[model samples]
Target chain A: MGIREKPTRMDQVQSWRADFPVEYLYTTGVAGERFAKTLRERGMLAATRCQRCGVTYLPPRIYCQRCFADLSESWVEVPLQGVIHTYTVVPVRATGEPSQSLEVIAYIRIDGTEGGILGRVAVSPEAVYIGMAVEGVLAPPAERRGAVTDIRYFKPILS
Target chain B: MARKRESSPQNPHDVGRVMREIPERPRGTPLKDQDIREGKVSLIAWKPHLEYRWDSGVAISRFLLGLKEGKILGVRCHSCGRTVTPPRAFCEWCFRPVDEWVELKDTGTVNTFSICYVTWDMKPLEIPQIPAVIEIDGTHPRVGFLHLLGGIGEKDVEAIRRRVRVGMRVQAVWKSPAERVGAITDILYFQPLE
Candidate 1:
């Protein structure tokens, strides 16, 4: 009816350690496919505009969240340039281990679009800053694959 | 007689209607898993390592400790008078803390069983494993826990199925003393008992 006995020592207590070995596949949706295709084939940035709210979405979407408009047929090519909205300097790798070098990850707001896409900034962390003008550097046309990685990375650009 | 309400934008009963053009077929590109495999479309693949450690509390801790010593432990609920193995602290029916720790025999009866042809990750196994609910001795009838059935020594499912049955006597096959760990895995499996 009451507490009889419990494992006081940590060693006496039983514990198990294991890791989830799971693999996942993420499909590029309708708008995502169109965006990737345009970037790969033409080296251009494509966006979908909501006619009702006049909001342009980069990494385009099929539906407008704000005005609830169908944006599938509103595909447009935005400028292949952007301004660095925000950034982070990571001293450690994704595996939670200290890295020999620092990496700069940033969200770049594509020109003439309402939303931004996350990208790696090629320059040193010290050189990266908010509002810095940057242009996307794409892979060679022959080697281009239909992925955001097709734009290898963004580099500093002169205004 | 009710008065006729004028059609105004602010009228609560009047529903605003819009003409929508519906397409003959569903929109957007659809690709099969095969298409992605063949590189027809883009897909992102990720494999993340998620680690975890689980603590075996009061009753289970003692139970696991008992298992490490090649013994099975159970808890008896004085209120319900039912002793359950793979023990728990509290009694489910009476909603009271268990009274005494009872060491049960490492023997049981097969309550139900199934022939598993695939492993946990769905990969086909060379020799199919038999998993069954074994009602441990000294516990209430039908009070059992799931464990694997081994020593069948047969690769054919039909042969194994024919040999195994409900109410068949089974005894826990414990690992060697050196291999003993405070875990259910200490008992490799349950085999048919005479």
Candidate 2:
């Protein structure tokens, strides 16, 4: 039954959707593997120091970018604290929907490390400001899985 | 070098292994699914959650709207003097812009197809899904896109492979207008025109 239909309208605009058909398995490389292993085993934060240039890297780098030298395996467990480098009030969801509430995303300069890591600051906008001291709030040891998510969210440490 | 098929006391018979006249190779051990399953190997497993919104440009936007209204549409490439389905804004044949639009008939011949036994995400299906390129009736010859073929002689792979052939006529089986989204899935499937 080949029934033909008439053209309705011409100016109608539409958007079609499909999910990104993907399952990603990432290898936490040379530096990240040990860093994550330490975080999973011990609740302390760790960083790598460049044996050549002596510059410490948080979220440890495999090599020192400044000296172009291979880094040492010397993992120094630092206190679970950092300062807010920068932040933004993300007004949208990861799904691109307008957020029901303000989500503050920030990059914190981790203590005892040159560079920092990006994390969420779970506090009111008024209470958050530049260079504010914050400590990583980790989940229980039994629930830790050696992932960045192991640190649930960062909370403001009373300065 | 001479091949060695030396025999032990168990065999003792004259043994000569047949060589296929190919280069002898070194063997490398491969990790099997069992290794990962049994946790013999240390690895991380993650299922990434992702979402994306694809922009339906000028041609596809109209094409999807047509599908919602139960119409198969194609852009007429005046530059190439031919009409192509799954409407394109540019004529790939002539390397020029296409400005004309046309509605194509539902019935067509099955140009080529396969008895796909798996879903898009590579999961096995109980009953096979037959995906085919059904050439549209009103458009130029061999102008078609990939879509599923269903309702063959029987719903089995045996019936589909033996019964479904190239040049066999087929028609679009549209979903109810209420169920039709402005997407390719609008047509539940294309069935053979008996």
Candidate 3:
């Protein structure tokens, strides 16, 4: 008669390893696609208006949130001038990639509009404020295809 | 501004009625289908593509190597005069470089901990694991690292902090050499010193 030795407990913990699948793909729809294109073509700002209540939206939508009505044809052209509402200087790289540098993101309240838009603030993070005036600038029409980056960023327009 | 005298029989709806003359333009033109289609097509054709990249750097990789060798590390903040566990290269408070490296004791006490019934991605975890906040000894008073605790029952999670007091002894339980990767998961868990 013979007895056998079982393997050490540490060996069991060491044997645990498995592959993790992590993949992500995101796509935007037609309404948003059209909004981006308009910004690039005429360097114009377009927002969605509720035909029922008359409230305009910066990032245009097909339906009105407050009125719960279809806002397919209720579009309006908004002036580019706006005021900086709030901003932050992001100094750290979020992902482990090498290309990220210190940048600033800001919330801008357009004139005569109820809400605002969130985008990269095209100014030194050091010299930004809550009441600073900003103007939206679009990329050249020939180069635009349909995306938020079409408008490069909101730059402080010194007046 | 002239006031009119009442000369007729009273009507309930006539209290606020007023009449005004109107003028009109020669013609009102409706937008043609070609114009509407042109506007829609022009709008869709102008969309732009946005792209950007960010880098987190090699701080985590270096810290994992220290843990694999059964050592605890802390990053020192010169500006605020404090050491932080799970070493950060920058002091979040002072916004300055944290260059000093301090080795902490393998032994530590549980400050606070939670028994995680779910996995990292919020799915139900197998074999129920206990994730503890281990306050390492001799580096910083409040500094702690998140790790699993062994030699205790899952039901004993609430009592772990009471049983393993603020100054209790603990040690790292390392996985086998073949399983060593530059990751925090390399250490299976911490066990109480008997």
How does residue B106 of candidate 2 score in lDDT? Answer: 83
lDDT of 2 by residue, A41-141 (tens): 89877787876687788878767788677665566777678999999988899879999888889999988788787898998887789999999999999
Residue B112 CA error for candidate 1 (Å)?
A: 0.8
Predicted candidate 3 versus true structure: per-residue lDDT over A38-138, tens digit per residue: 67666666788886787888777878888688776877877777999988888765564543666778889987666677878778877998999998876
Q: Rank the candidates by DockQ, best first.
A: 1, 2, 3
- lDDT (tens digit, per residue) of candidate 1 on B1-194: 24445533464456577536886776656677789779877777788768899887787887888889999988899888998877888898999888888889999999999988897899998888888999999999899999999998898878987889999999999999899988899999999997
List ranges where model 3 is wrong by over 4 Å.
Answer: A1-11, A14-27, A96-101, B1-194
Error of 1 at B27 (Å): 6.6
Estimated TM-score for each candidate: 0.86, 0.66, 0.40
What root-mean-square deviation over C-alphas does model 1 reach? 4.8
Evaluated at residue B163, the lDDT of candidate 3 is 52
Docking class of 1: medium
- Measured with C-alpha atoms, the lDDT of residue B36 in candidate 2 is 63
The recovered share of true contacts, given per candidate in order, is: 0.71, 0.53, 0.00
lDDT of 1 by residue, A1-159 (tens): 343666678877787788888889888887877888898889998899988898898779989989688888999997679899999999998789998889889999999999888988888987889999999898999988878888888999965
lDDT of 2 by residue, B57-175 (tens): 77788788899899999877655678889887788888777767888888889999888778878888778778788889888888899998876646676767677888888888889
Q: Please tell me which predicted candidate would have the highest lDDT against the true structure.
A: 1
Clashes per model (N, Cα, C within 3 A):
0, 0, 10
- Judging by DockQ, tell me the better candidate of 1 and 3: 1
